[model samples]
Target: MNKITIFHNPRCGKSRETLKLIQEKVSDDDIEVVKYLEDVPSEEELKNILTMLGVKAGELVRKNEKIWKDNFKGKDFSEDGLIKVMVENPKLIERPIVIKDGKAVIGRPPEQVYSIL
Candidate 1:
């Protein structure tokens, strides 16, 4: 089995649900939970995740977050600039990103992670 890692934000209900679903579907030892707020992903890590997710840096952002609204909304950013912003402000990262076997999915509906597994 492939190793699984979830970038989880416990405060978000969707993130929690994704975590629970992973727990139910995957062995405890195979899954690793990263409390992203406390342990933020570096710029390089975020870049790798974006590649795995097959998405642009902007696509991985949570534009609804106040940080994005107040700081980045309506602003045009280069791909690297967006990645740098997300790295600097983890709150702008979409929740419950599950990574497995070099593929990644945003667990917005939570079930999305199943495909990557």
Candidate 2:
């Protein structure tokens, strides 16, 4: 089986739930849980994830996040600029992104991971 990776924030309930759902469907060895808050994704990595998720950089942002609202809201950033911001502020990225076999989904509902799996 291919590796399944999840960009997880352990403190977030949705992230934790999504991780648990992935665990139920996949073996531990096949799963990689990323604590993105501590180990942020690079701009390039965020771009790749954006590709996998089939979304633009801004689409992956957690707009409701205080960091985004207080700092980045109402700003018009280029695609690369948004990606850079997400790299610098991982909290602005959406929760529980699951990726496998070149496909990805934002696991807001947790069940979304199944589509990629």
lDDT of each: 0.91, 0.91
* Clashing pairs for predicted structure model 1, backbone only: none
The reply for model 1, stretches above 4 Å from the true place, is none
Per-residue C-alpha lDDT of model 2 across residues 4-113, encoded as one tens digit per residue: 99999899999999999988988999999889999899888999999988899988999998988899899999999999999998989998899899999999798888
Q: Quick one: RMSD of model 1?
A: 0.9
How close is every model to the real structure, measured as TM-score? 0.95, 0.96
Off by over 4 Å in 2: none
CA RMSD per model (angstroms): 0.9, 0.8
Superposed by TM-score, candidate 2 places the C-alpha of residue 39 at a distance from the truth, in angstroms, of: 1.1
Instruction: Work out how many backbone clashes candidate 1 has.
Output: 0
Clashes of each: 0, 0
lDDT of 1 by residue, 3-110 (tens): 799999989999999989889988999998999889999989999999999999988889888888898999999999998898899998998899998999999899
